[model samples]
Target: MRKLKIGYIPMFRGTARGDREILERISKELTDLSRTMDFDLKIGSEIVFGYDTAVKAVAEMNSFDPDFTFLGSYGATIGSAMIPMDKLKGLIGLWAVPEWELTGRLPLNAFCGSMINAGMLAKFHTEKHIPFKWFYGYTDDPLFIDRFKVTFQALKAIVALQESRIGLIGPVVDGFDYMLVRESSIYDLYGATVDRHHSVEEVIKRAKDQSEAAVKDELAAILAEGSKTCMVDDEAMNRFARLSLALSDLARDNGLNAISMSCWTNIEFNYGNAPCSAISRLNNKGIIAGCEADIDGAIGMIISRAMADADAATMCDLVSVDRADDSLNIWHCGPAAGCLANKCGVKWDHHFDMGHYEGDEWHGYGVVADLTFKPGDITLSRISTEAKELTAFGATMFDKESYQGCSGWIKDYRMGGKPMTLAELLSVIYNNRVDHHMSFAYGNFESSLIEFANWKGISVAKNTGYVDHMELGTLGK
Candidate 1:
């Protein structure tokens, strides 16, 4: 994958003298941060202290073309910084570096300038329809960095989607007519190009072509990685290994960032096995695969992965509701991501119930990684295109440690609104025509998603209904 590029523009008042020192200090800090941080950030070298200089710097940075531009006010007042901002097409964000405390007057006036710029840009962006974000804090604060990183990742995901090529192999499961996505709609809304491969036969053929030695080696690796194994006989392991390798090659050969595969009737019945294990393995390795040929689910998985810093995300059905505990059960027949598996480790298991279970032979070699998801806060997101318009919604869910074999409960749920009853939540989902499958990754990414929605000019009517206290389950009464 390509590294996320971020251009840094240090700003100061045009008439402000003796500001170069603070500017240099902040620049050097960013340089050091770029080397230390795990996420990729490409900081630009130029500094802006005037309208003319700002225009020149922006022009130069434009040539470099960053995913987002960071406009920082270091010891300078907020004046005409908006001049350069008008030219940028990507997301624009502001950094209000905290003022260094002293016995006398503030040295940088950084916070004051940042706040002013924020207010000014808020109006400017609103009137001009420009997308922007702002943060006020010390450079190294963990919370500040975390929030910024979330925004950064969101921008990265948006850019990735624009540059991505997604593959849809085979048709969606029958009767899931709603899940069939129009490629033109994806291109129009997200700029992602989709290619449809009409047959799962190609995947099976590729799996069969792998050398036996290679398949055995992959099987050994899988066994070693698992903390515990169950019912994973040689046949299942071998089959899964071949399928996994083949899928990896298919993705690489096609230059696909993600894939949506139809896994029901054709691949499972004719091939005598489900591709759940292969899907799980691909997700663990960062090649997102959505089951039942869910293109939007694959896109949502990629979005969650990027926003959560490449954390593994899975596409799962909202299979059951637990009103007693006020949670929803998220399950997908054995395709839960292996990386999200709890300490108990992933189990080699069979499909839930999809097979010929007659007297003599049960031909379904389910071949799946089974485990309860690890307990943590998670975000649920789904993207859809209906009526030629793109719509998406995101909310946070608290996953519990309590596991029942191959599923996890979203015992805690919060959307941007007043605290809601389980019924109210269900009503919201039902009323909005949400898809059955939702993509989930571990993190509280509600704010990030909202910001992304703003930048993309996508409607946020379904998501913008909550206050922060709702996240704490307080309802903000």
Candidate 2:
């Protein structure tokens, strides 16, 4: 992952009697933090006092081309704050430090300065629409650090999205119209490119070309990890290994950050094996992969991985909503990363739905990783078909038994900081027409995802109950 670049300009009123000692201490602490954290911090050489100084400071920071900038209020004049707020290009941070002592004319009116800055920016930037976040307390304060880290993580995720290059291998599966997305809209909104597209036949040819000697190590590794194998034969396992290697090479050669493939009936019919286990292996290797040629779903997985800074995220469907246990079943045809397997461990098996299709040769033709997801906190998110809205929620996956093929049961759902019942969640999904596929990872990234959505000017669907009225004009309001 790339480290975020952050620029900091400390401001103070020239005439105010401010404590230089405190300002120096804050600077040192921030410098130390930059060394330890995942961002590269560039602090201003001297504090800005007046409009001219503020302008020069802003120019210097702008030259840095930071993803985010911070206007640190040492005891700043309103003009100083406005200068950077107006000129800075991306998300801004208004940082205000509390006074060490209350007596004797207040050493530094930092809080008041920042409050005025916030109000001024809110009014002036409403039209310009510059986004900014508020930060209060000393540099070493725990709460301040927490908010700062979240902001940093959110900014990093945004960068990840903008720089991502996704490969669409084959079109959305037949009849899955909701999985379609406009490539132009995706580039316009997220700055991610989906220019690379390959037919299912092209990938199949690549897989067939792989020699037995080439896939020996990969097959060995896959078999070594599985506690047991069922239904799937040696031919199916070898095909999976070849497909995995082929996908890896394609991603590396094309400089692709993620991939979405039509890994269903098409691949199964053409190649005699589903790409589930291969997709799982790619995800475990940090190449984000989504099945059914769901470009938006792949993007959702990219967002989850970026926010969690984790290598793998699972793309699954909400198969069942059990009111009895207040839990929802999250399952897929087995493309989940091996790291998510429960204590029962990963096993090799045929796809659960393979029997539905015709042909005796197709029996045990689907190679999939069969395992239940380990118990942990999870974050579920999906990008709407139009790429204009995002739905995200957090839940806890229970330790109870789950069905095979990358499955789990999650309860205790929460969205927008409020507890949500399974019934309400189901209503939200159905009424909103959310995509059947949601990408998730084992962590609480709801807040980071919300921040990312806000930064991108994408509307986040509310967690409230279903609404019947259209209200055309007030769509995003």
Instruction: Give model 1 RMSD, 1 decimal.
Output: 5.4
| Candidate 1, 1-477: lDDT as tens digits | 476667777777634444666667766777776777544555556667657777877887788777777888765544676666778646677887765665576567776776666776667556676656776665678645876776876776787788788888889889899988789888887788998964698998988899989998888877775632443466767778888998989999999878999997668776767788888888888888888888888888877787777557888877787767778877787776777887777877766566566677454466777788877777776666543223333333444554333578775456663344556566556545677888888877766776676676664434334343324221222
CA lDDT of each prediction against the hidden true structure = 0.72, 0.82
lDDT of 2 by residue, 181-222 (tens): 998888888888995568888888888898878899888888
Model 1, TM vs. native: 0.81
TM-scores of the candidates are 0.81, 0.93
Candidate 2 similarity to native, TM-score: 0.93
Best by TM-score: 2
> Candidate 2: lDDT of 106?
76
Report each candidate's C-alpha RMSD, comma-separated, in the order given. Answer: 5.4, 2.8
